[model samples]
Target: MSPDTRIHRARVLALSLGGLMALAVAVYMTLGAVGSWSFVLSYRGEKLLTILLVAWAVPVSTVLFHVISRNQILTPSIMGFDALFMLIQTLAVFLIGAATVTQWPPVLVFLGELTAMVAFSTLLFRWLFGRIAQSLELLLLVGIIFGVLFRSVAGLLQRLIDPGEFLVLQDRLFASFSGADPQVLAMSAALVAAASLWAIWRLPAIDAMILGRDGALAVGVPHRRMTAEVFLIVTLLVAAATALVGPITFFGLLVANLAYRLLPGAPLRLTLPLAGLLGALLLVGAQVVLERVLGFTGTVGMVIEFLGGLLFILLLIERAR
Candidate 1:
């Protein structure tokens, strides 16, 4: 297809995504009308807002990450952020007790975890990117190793805790849109807005990155500097989103690859927005089915993980061949 044709097709698909997202929102709000309109609107509205935030944060992080890594299979979760966040939660319950943590204000708890993950990511990325900014291999390798270590440590601690405490901890074992914190949501909105602007400004360097480090440098892109900047952006967005909605292991993988297939050879400018719309639609639509249609038979996160894992394996086999 000609370049003009490709761009036109991308725009058409994007509009389709928006239309579906609007339909999903309509169903989510009105499908289960019951008692008070005020109560229903206030309650469901928060959940919708949380879903929208994750919709933006997760796909944007994953797509921008693809720009740097030049691969569609790997996700930001590979950085060990999910495991690290779980460890933080496990440690808090093990030492301080879940009941106490639960009693504390949700906003404070959210802020605390968000701060820890962001701070650790900053230090970790600064150290890693300093020496091996050009070596995506080493970065991913270390991340896998740390993920194992963190999960092992958290698991060991969990075993020692009481059964009641373990049950309490299970709420966080999967991602949930319920209990969306108002303060954290506002803060996350600001962070995502700022990150989006910075990412837009770096689009040229990001586009060049698909040419690989040497080619980017040849094209006047500061490959190493841009790589570091891109990773920092990924870390910020992923950490904030994970802290907000627990850990989402494979949702990004699902939405991102779908966006790639939907807009083949499209620019990041087109692909990223399309991915975000797909994310929002899938999330809201899935939530509707789970609650209204399926009667909450399963959590949204697990469903996404199962489907994404299948896709992950298919991609792996394709690459192996």
Candidate 2:
């Protein structure tokens, strides 16, 4: 289909996503009044914000990542982002006592994480792409391998830490989405906004990049620089989400594949926006179903991951045939 047709279809998809979001908001409002409006609203509001942030952060990064790499299966999480995040937290506890690490203000911790992720991504891309001409599949394989290395290293370090420190590490790793500092939320929103604006400026280039290396280079696009910039952005976005809500694997894989399948006729202009909206809708809808219908089971992420993994497999098989 032509770009115009894709854009029109994307507009239609956007309308659908907007409708679902509106529905979710209405449901929340009705349920919000069902209990103590003050207490329940305050508590649920934090969760809603986390869901929105993760929703925006993950799919955008993943989609742009695929565009840069020219591969649908490549995701930001596959690049050792979550593993690096966990490694940092584990190393912090191991280096400093658990109390000291835990007592360090969250803002400082956030900054430290942001810095480390930027550095790691810089090194990762510089090395990975700097080598001789490589395929997107090769990049994906390397990323997955590096992610495993990071996870193994982090796990081994965790074993060496004292049991008490391990307890603290576990808390940092698996906390509920119940509380988030308002200040941190504001900072995170600002970062996402800035990155998004940059993304908008680079959108045309991204569309070009999706055509692969030679195609982009032929069109006067600097593929290497764009890849590096996108890698940095993806890492930053993933780190922000991890810092916000611990690592929830497969969320991006699920949503991005769904968006692609459902919106083949949608261009980047429409696909990116619709994908973000669908992500928010899925997460918020799941939160509502889990809390209200399921009586607050602590396995929303696990359930979503399970379903998403299955979806990923089905999509792969469909693509193969």
Candidate 2, residues 163-233: lDDT per residue as tens digits?
Answer: 98899898778624557777777788788888888888888887888778889899998987887777777
Instruction: Please identify model 1 stretches exceeding 4 Å from their true place.
Output: 132-134
Report the error of model 2 at residue 89, Å. Answer: 2.0
TM-score of each: 0.96, 0.89
CA shift at 127, candidate 2, in angstroms? Answer: 3.3
Error of 2 at 199 (Å): 0.7
Query: How many clashes in each candidate?
Result: 0, 0
Q: Report lDDT per candidate.
A: 0.87, 0.79
Q: Output the TM-score of candidate 1.
A: 0.96
Task: Name the runs in model 2 displaced over 4 angstroms.
Answer: 1-5, 29-40, 131-141, 162-167, 319-321
In candidate 1, position 300 carries an lDDT of 95
Measured with C-alpha atoms, the lDDT of residue 58 in candidate 1 is 96
**Compared with the true structure, what per-residue lDDT tens digits does model 1 show for residues 77-128?**
8878899999999998999998897888877877788788777766766677
- The clash tally of candidate 1 reads 0
Prediction 2 TM-score vs. true: 0.89
